[model samples]
Target: MGHPHRLGIVGLGNISAAYLDTLADSAQIRITAVADLDTARARTLADRLPHARALSVSELVASDEVDTVLNLTIPAAHAEIALAAIGHGKNVYGEKPLAARMADAREIVAAALAAGVGLGSAPDTVLGTGLQTARHAIDDGLIGRPLAASAVMVTAGHERWHPSPDFYYQSGGGPLLDMGPYYVAALVHLLGPVRSVTGAASRLRGTRTITQGPRAGAVIPVDVDTHITGVLEHDSGALSTITTSFDGAATDAAPLEVHGENGTLSVPDPNRFDGETRFFELGATQWRPLPTAAGYLDSARGIGLLDFIAAGPDRAARANGDIALHSLDVMTSLLQSAAEGRRLELTTTTERPLAVPLTAREVWSQRE
Candidate 1:
């Protein structure tokens, strides 16, 4: 509605730095205000931005100068912040794990729909050139008729680096809910919405030790699932084996691979913005990197927000919240399936319009 979108950021945590760095040079959105439960932290971030003021959550949400609220709060706060922004007639872009529960995520969506305002969520990794290129190749029939896929993500635990890692072991921050969105979102973009899901999860580590940082040598209890493996049945008749762990060692596990009738498309780590994706034909001995029409130039958050804003008010807006909710449903089914030892059926389907194309220059120019 204005010359440039006005952005009001609600949380000034470590992850918020990434968004600030990316927005620093953008002309599309200006940081008008910032807020955090810790007023000092909010002030710190605001001090670094031009014409940005630190304020309370209520003030930020109620500010008429702010057109969009970037909900960077913790997982438990996502639904509340977004709902408040929507209630105030402001567009909202929330961080991942949209909400702690499926019902809450649905409520946020419903509120946005009722308010007729824009709603988006993050872990926008799917928009990266790596995944987008893979999507394009699959759609172009380079990997005719997807048959199956797999994704594996592992970390010793976040206590090593995160100043406050206690939440990661809580309900909203386990391996399934924490890292599952990135992989699941990519799968949805490539394969389609899941038809069913079954999973087996366990607290593989009784306690986790911080390997580095000031917290080194500190041990923390692992209350949630530290290891989870699941089977996803997609509407396209493709099966995806997904797994995540906070208790495992490192390996050169490919992030994702789609087996198709003609060949296999191996996608680089979906969590990143740029990488070479390879396609191996049935008869070929080697995997060849597919030529990208354009380079991915946006930061983790920039691409999704830019696209949503670029689509303008008339077009159907795409955001991470939709994918986050679907991912939550899949994870919920996985937990249920694991308990019952049977596949859980999913009623929703994943479908999107054809992807916008990018020129090679556009794709390559964005690389750091």
Candidate 2:
């Protein structure tokens, strides 16, 4: 292999640890620098890595030691950090939604394209066996022709668990924006890009009290809608119904379900890396568990970055910027439709990402 990609990470928040754990022993990549709003936090993390140093966010993005920026910052900071990395001629891979708004998302994509740098987004969980196996089934005609799907995510709220859950209720953070990316990305993988959307939304309550963490018993204001329902019309003519809520206590609904001409497929939660995919044929008496047949087995958060690097000069990364931009467009358009009380056509579209062939842990753990 050639030189490992030098990674400079911005944002040392909750999700950062998961990525660190996934990439700690990688041979194809190296963590060279760390940065966060809290210098002490960045220093603490960098101290643990023999080859890494703590730096300010701006310094890290401009440093000669870094070739790519792994952005784990909040949604509001996503575009800012990404643009800085792109401006310095470095590739970027960031947490979902691409950015807090479509305009920023477009600017980031355009900047990366103009700078000739690769850009990637997260919720790479779809690259795992759970979603890929189901996609494999659909592609192999096990379900004939897919006609529709349903994605449901219901939770009381995040304040009960997350100490810094203020973002969950902020403008860029809502039940739909928080949890919708996983399901929407998975739907794009299972079905195809959405062409139009119709939606309705509501806010359940004005305030919520934190039940755990340092902020336990503290009340926070709710600004965005707590419940969101929408219909996505896919380019393939498949229709999908989606419901995301922070107002509910719990639900037993299959996290996702796809129905086709000859059968129905029950997909596991898209937020997870792997789970059992069950199928019920048109005439079958019961649902049967489908064997895992595709994707990176035992993969985690960093696999998407590895995949982006491995994609080389020949093809787009499965989690490339276009898919992310389109997904965000679909989501934002849904909310816009809700506000306008009318169906809205999407302004962007993308080809369905290439499928991941069944791959083992050892095979995908390193860059191909």
Candidate 3:
């Protein structure tokens, strides 16, 4: 390892803890500062690290000590924080769905390109061995030529468990925008970018009452579609059906499956790092399990961050900001297609590459 990169993290929300806990053990990057609208929360996170301080967003971005800014802020603040980091001449790594709107996402990408700084986003979940193996199998023709795919993501609404679930029903917080990144990213990885899309969406319920956490019994109104179904036409002529909902009950199976001419590949749950992969031959009797491989150990996000740090300024990886923004566009188009009742066309595509081979130490190391 060379010199460690200094990191300043913005957003001390619920998900920030997962990233911080993983960064605590990595020597490649160091958290030099943390910032949040809630100063107390920022201090709480800062206290866990040595030589780390809690600062305001402006201070964190303008400080010369920071080389990179991790934008863990909500969807609404993604563009603001990311653009600020770029304007301050620092690299940036943000959480998924780069921005709430396509125009904002495009602006962030443009700013990063203009600054010539490293910019990336997550849902890095595809880097997990589960998806990697699936990609490998697909490429190896174990599944023959890819023909079609189906992804279904359903939830009983976040109000039941999240302390503050108001954002989930909003424009940036709907099922397609919030959870669509993972599925869309995986699809882009496996099937490439979509050429067109058609969809239908609906609001399952007008209002939802919190049933768990501190906000229990609080009712939140829904303004966005809670249920969405989309048909994606891949450039390769392959098609896919993607459906997401906030009104369904839990099921044992995953939400996505890719079918090919030779076999049907059962993917792991899109939301998880690793699960199981089953292959169903054209005329097979039952689904067969594939060999287990090294998957992500620390919530999946760490994998992309580590890769970014390792690669440094030399080369870019699959989790680059452009790919993330493309995925966001796909999701956005899905919603637009639903509204217009017309097929939406896309101008970008991403090739699905084989997973990076795992080294011995990487496979053995366990999170403390």
Candidate 4:
């Protein structure tokens, strides 16, 4: 485990480039193989990475050179790829929401446990400086006994710029499921596990047209809710109101915030690795920036995967299946509650994953 965690990437889409940029300099992982349903795409990516070979999806998942599967596939295919990798006795670290369905995601967790391999998933943005600073503030009582939080994400839609936008409108690709993971994960980090939720949603448009890329002006039908608003009741007695949408133009809401008996904190966007965390105490007249006291420095997407593997054999990965599954359960229940017109109690709950103290890559990926 002292050496790099050889990675077999299963998707080579737009987002894969961002990951490649991070992996280029990582100390804990390196891409050894690349795969996609589009063989040409896989080959093209492999050609660029040093020593990375192109493989079929099945081949990549089972390759002897690969230790973990990096799943960058679409939301619908996440579970399928993960199960394949886990079945081959490889660890898997994937993009957010874990999987599209609760049952499917649960299967990945169960299989990983059965195989004795670790499980992990993203928005490891929680392991970054901005949120970690806020968490430190909470732990230090800068925010006295966290009382509540609110998370908001709003955009007209992704069709304005994305080339192939069909998946954003499909069964697993609504604003809540697609984008809610970041907000929900951050909320859990800030406020702890959610116990129940009551949600209401709206879909103001039936179809959307792509305004950018090769498929410009191509219309896509919308099947899932485009605007979702809900409240999560955390097990710690903290409450959070969340609103995620692809229907609105914009809003002035902070991406995230936490309030407590002593102060309030304005958190940076959870989708990013770093930003300023602002705080305003009860007696203060102005919001001041908190010094970055924790988390990875200048971290990037793949760093979370490094952190996951660096957790050693005994400690759970900082971005783990239980937390991801809990996040998914909260989101799915919110949408279900909206559909059923009732508050739904969650069956899943996760302990807050251990917080990351400020550390460099070398120090974190080491054995004393």
RMSD of each: 2.6, 1.4, 2.1, 2.0
Candidates ranked, most accurate by lDDT first: 2, 4, 3, 1
Report the C-alpha lDDT of model 1 over 251-327, residue by residue, as the tens digit.
Answer: 57888999999999889797887788899999999988997743244446556666666566456545545666787
lDDT of 4 by residue, 115-173 (tens): 98878998888888988888989988888899999999999999987899899899888
Candidate 2 local lDDT, 173-271, one digit each (tens): 998888999999999999999999999999989998989887799999998999999999999999999999999999999999999999999998999
Put the candidates in TM-score order, highest first.
Answer: 2, 4, 3, 1
In model 4, what lDDT does residue 182 have?
Answer: 90
Error of 3 at 161 (Å): 0.9
Judge candidate 2 at residue 245 and give its lDDT: 96
**TM-score for predicted model 4 compared with the true structure:** 0.97
TM-score-wise, the better of 3 and 4 is 4
lDDT of 4: 0.89
Clashing residue pairs, backbone N/CA/C < 3 A, model 3: none
Which candidate's TM-score is highest?
A: 2
**Model 4 ranges off by over 4 Å:** 361-368
The model with the greater TM-score, 2 or 3, is 2
Q: For candidate 3, lDDT tens digit of each residue in 1-368?
A: 23577888999888887776667766677789999999998898789888689999999999988998989989888999999999999888899889988899899888989988888898778877777768778877899999999998888888878889888887688888888888988888888878888989998788999888877898988989998999999888999999888878875555789999999999987777677888999999999998755444434555677666666444566688878878887888888989988988975555553355543434423333
Question: How accurate locally, in lDDT, is each candidate?
Answer: 0.79, 0.92, 0.82, 0.89
Candidate 4 — worst ten consecutive residues by lDDT sum?
A: 359-368
> Each model's TM-score, in the order given?
0.93, 0.98, 0.94, 0.97
